[model samples]
Target: MPAVSSPQPSATSQPHHRFIKISRYIYVFREFSKFSIWTPHVSFLQSLRRLAPIPSPSFFQTLDIVAENPDKFRIVGLAAGSNVTLLAEQVKTFKPQLVAVRDESLVNELKEALADMERKPEIIPGEQGVIEVARHPDAVSIVTGIVGCAGLKPTVAAIEEGKDIALANKETLIAGGPFVLPLAHKHKVKILPADSEHSAIFQCIQGLSEGALRRIILTASGGAFRDWPVDKLKEVKVADALKHPNWNMGKKITVDSATLFNKGLEVIEAHYLFGAEYDDIEIVIHPQSIIHSMVETQDSSVLAQLGWPDMRLPILYTMSWPERIYCSELTWPRLDLCKLGSLTFKAPDNVKYPSMSLAYAAGRAGGTMTGVLSAANEKAVELFINEKISYLDIFKVVELTCEKHQEELVATPSLEEIIHYDLWARDYASGLERTSGLSAVPA
Candidate 1:
């Protein structure tokens, strides 16, 4: 699992933090609950008793049965960078049949990454290269990681296949929730959260009447240039943005940490995930990144999800829903010693980081704006990673792309149309007025 680490360290390391204790207990429960499967609530409660190494054999075995049962689970993984290995390992361990669609070269590379899984657990496809599932109808699910439209098709396929989703991609939901969510509801399927921030929001909203949710607060680490002068941002090098102070992430997301686009998409995500109006969600730059997200109740008290900014911790929780269970994320004390400092919260500086407002506007505009912005940001991040653009140009390209598409209709397009919009934004941003103008990739 990709670690969902926060971007900024605690300013004052404490010997102990409450989040550490809670996550450990939660981890154990998620692991054990997988076998106690028939009754998720029982599985959830049963896991609470085991505190040591999680129950790998029984838990994964239960999952294996589901993988072997085609009617139970149909699995798919969207394109991503380093995390593809984790996805492969997950498919191998869980023994789920996997589907991946990308450039042929990438799929071949992915096969190579998981070649070791084949040798070990050895899920050999028949001579025809097809792994058939078992009978008894598996209570299966699909996984998606849509950074934007990149993973949209795979996500739609999995959802359409009647697989409840483990959604890591916020863009799919944010851009197409109006259509996608209704479809899930119609099929009586659930969209489980895999992003820590959104998962935290999902966790907090449970057992409460929907009407009681007043608002949600999404936290951000404010990236590499949180306080760097706006005037100086255009010159920020790849290393500078990639140098996230708190989180260890893929290089592209680390750059996004600097731009606040991750949090922006989260805002849109929260809107769809909870059915909150665009204005109902708030953004706070918590340099500490300890509080993944918070929910405000009708009574005005704010309940927050605080953890050690770890992604797998939440991903495991969703695997066994409606109950708090344990998984691999719970092993650490988070800090072996006094480490995390006092958590701090601040309002974002919109002038310095205009992308913040742009995301909000895209969400509010409520059409293909979110899609365009997301696709544009993907390209900008790509350009930045390839040294074709600077850190500042990312927001510029996204903002421009969004501005170009703000007036687009709000209706959900056929999968083909979403792909079309995605491609157009990437092309449009490539022509953005960067002084570097293809001369400088942000090295």
Candidate 2:
């Protein structure tokens, strides 16, 4: 039997900080290629800082990490819209070369916000600007932090430009895996996982030889409703779902956790990232979230990456791959297993969370089905958040939308088809609220 290779030390003599930028999408971009774009929004920034030892530091704490080390990193490009003041601060502090907003109307708003700044970045409006940032000539890595299918095109543009992707957006793999994976292979672009679970698995498998991996065990915190009975789910409210027990994240992701759709999406992402068959991947409820994820080898040896629920480690590894960064123990607390009495695990209840089955089936269906499943879920969550659909209707909308898309499922989708179906699924899922008789549950 071949021996498992241990991780090697960094080849560089000196530790150099690479220019890392934030993007609003589910990803972050950094230097390596010609141009790279980053746009970390308020929720993303908050999510990154939530698990830190500090108590509610300023909202720009995430970007401050990059700003502190000016020599190691540069802010090249950014995309934002929701919080103009926050965006203005980022622009003022980092002085990125290019900026992109949600739309043309917000362009002036951002400009006016940056009026006091001595150097202003050229602001481009809408999706085109985002694509430009993704494919920026100077960027070596692009972080796909944008939510949903909105991230697919920009990520593709970045990959086409030969930028390594620090993928925070699960939808990129869940939806665009069929198309994007091939594109990455063709361009020699590396698709690195930034999510804790996927990054844990990625770290565990780093030195393992090909075909040695047997099974993947994805750990879940079980979200806010983990302890609630199946019958109690229908009574769940947006605020109730938003109350995550472990991680403080954006509304959409927090809701995804409560539904276990986040885990479901991660399952699909694992399949694409590690080429594991859906049957080979398993989900276990680990309430503590201490062990991010684990992988089993052919000999049944389990390798797991353990860390505090903080997202910084995983995101940091994405940038410093092939080289581990030395983080001060003060800011980055070391995990103390002795202090935590015990770690617990259990099999997830399928009856309570239908997202697992839906995601697996869509993954098995291949082609555009996974994308449809993700888009539908995103739309369904939106409806539930708006009180336009009952909590239970979230599952119904996704299942029904996937069912309706069976006929049009493309086995090997083009980029255009992927985008088309993404938009189509969101539209179809939204229509189900009216046609499928889904009513909002009273708060």
Candidate 3:
């Protein structure tokens, strides 16, 4: 994943200052917003204003809104990649009493950086660190920003601690929804959506009964290959596949976007997040990317969430749910629609995006099969990025792995069984060589 830069202190400010370091707030706001591409400077500035303030003796401490609010988070657990680093910087602004990273190396880095502070938060290390962060005395919510299925275990652990989850990792629910959802219910913990699409659907359905909804309309940018013909996918190069039209994201997801596998995974996520069936969840090609998602009511009315494709809006909401905090972003261009002239939608071409169909099949198969499907796709994408496989071969690897593991599929897999199947799929995909029995060509 592409990591955002850590918020630095200004030249004149103390190194331990919690305020986002910038010589010029407007300049930093524009540059940071433009560079992220997903969130604009205008909205970002407003969002920063909305954060709960923290009081400090330093000149910039007055700008630290995170500490003054009692409802503000005081302990955060982060993992996965670069996004974790960026979020860690923001979390520090709140002066969290405890934070967790995935490894000792990160612990060392945090220790060195936070050493100058008057009160350094406790930093925990390793995968166990995630659970520890959640179980901290003051911990109220766990922001799971990790990528892939690695997020599954810690998330379950956090829920077991009775901590609410602000979930950014889609694979957690995609592969382990059957197990995780039940655990959440038993623990009485809320699973909030951190992804923009699911957040939109969650917001739209807030006051309505589940039965009142007819279907979910998930909008897709059609990815880097959206404009390419089905036959041309065989010739796709890694460079070509990473050219996402709207969002700048990690390589795996960007490639998944190209194959429509991301949307497929989202379909499975939507199923678990909203209790929707496979048939009722739909994908549409909305190239403009203005509307994040839509929900159709039984009465034939569609409620759509429209905004500029700024991820911060959703992330902010996930952090402060059931309450809309004040932010300076009321004027960001993403909130403006007049400049964005037209909006259009078309049916997704499953022929061009085979991963789309494969996802639905995996979702319907229901059991450890989804884990198998996710594991296979993750390995294939890694192989493609490393130049060991063709873009088209990504789908082929997933298909073969799913087929080879058909007998291994369990209708209701225990958490241990799910992990076992996930590992098996990884080994199965990684073991596929050019000389292996499976064809190297895309199916």
Candidate 4:
């Protein structure tokens, strides 16, 4: 094609091209040989990851992937769920062996106990991996001094053995932060979050320079009572408090939601999880619950994670962070649906819900304020369910509990002292009966 006449083909030039082809083939053979040596070792581990767990159609169930590779890891489930059935299907697709199917039968237990609210009994709905309690070589014991059940000892043992934890139980950290965080550091295992708010903050802050993050703003739905008049709150029943208008959740969380106490717990979590100080975090009530949480940079710009009021999205997010998976079964949000209404936000009313302030107080005080707040709320909610106090009185008991423990907070006591304070708060709050619907047992 060149205008010049082509030179006669030469055997000497031909040998150069022939040599190049041979070189490429040799390189390919070397790679194939190395792969042969490694593939069996990798596949053997993959089989172990698939060990007793049946897939839940509702969750993304992407654990087997993390199982296959050392780098792929994520949280399973916590909070309540919206698309549990779909997540189960996704898990089957990924074909993970271990799944967290937290007693589907307890759905009736939750619904029966939470008859006043629209709490549907179902799986927490995210990771469908079976957490073999003691099967792994490195089993960690997870415990928190408060809450309905004990979780820390098992979590500690598991972490001690070398298994990284998928942490959902906040009270464990509340009571055992000094022990747990240090031990996790010593062992160098993972402590993944199961709380939506903390998970959101964790995702947003990833890879950001320290100086870039000005602060974190944790959002709350403000519960069903956000619109209820403060004057009339005393007459509110446990049934009324259980009704969260947007998200379907459990009785424990629903009660915490009503008081915005769960949000308070998240504030404490963000402090410990991210190492931010007392003033660095703030809370704003976003009623729709679409905007799960946000973080602000020093430049004044804010980053937020948005989705439907579905816990599975965040659960899957924790499991599938850094790389988003394609789930054909999951629904995508329409711009038309999202843009139809203004997303509203307001500062949490300090007068109506003082729990947020106490949370900040507990977090600032460190030691065991988080443990105390969790235990007190549990005790107060129990009293509400027993008809000893009206719904509004839940906050009253919690407030007095905090006030009574003011000295403990100020002193910044030891972890042992904090656990003692947590137990004392629970027992003291439970002792008094509902004197008036307007208020409750003072610590």
TM-scores for the candidates: 0.72, 0.87, 0.79, 0.67
Q: Candidate 4, TM-score vs. the true structure? A: 0.67
Candidate 2 regions exceeding 4 Å error are 1-61
lDDT of 2 by residue, 135-167 (tens): 766666666677788778888988888777777
> Candidate 1 vs candidate 3: which has greater lDDT?
3
The residue ranges of model 4 lying beyond 4 angstroms of the native Cα positions read 1-135, 138-149, 329-340, 406-420, 434-443
Model 3 spans with C-alpha error above 4 angstroms: 1-94, 105-115, 436-443
Tens-digit per-residue lDDT, 197-316, candidate 3: 887887787667536776678889999988888888777778898899998776888898898888988988887777776767778889988888998787767899887766556765
In order, the Cα lDDT scores of the candidates are 0.57, 0.74, 0.64, 0.53
Model 1 agreement with the true structure over 1-443: per-residue lDDT tens digits: 11112222232342211110111001112222111121110011011122112111122332343343333233321222334455465556444432332323445656776776644322323211111111112323444543456445545554555545566667677666656777677665557666788778878876666377766788888988887988887787777888998877777678778888888888777767666665566778899878888977767678888777655556555655655543333353353224665778887777766666777777777656677777788888988877886676677677767777755654666656666777888898877745554446433
Candidate 3, TM-score vs. the true structure?
A: 0.79
Local error of candidate 1 at residue 360 (angstroms): 0.9
How accurate locally is residue 18 in candidate 2, as Cα lDDT from 0 to 100?
A: 28
Selected candidate, larger lDDT, 2 vs 3: 2
Candidate No. with top TM-score: 2
- Backbone clash numbers for all candidates listed: 24, 33, 12, 43
The residue-level lDDT of candidate 2 at 413 comes to: 94
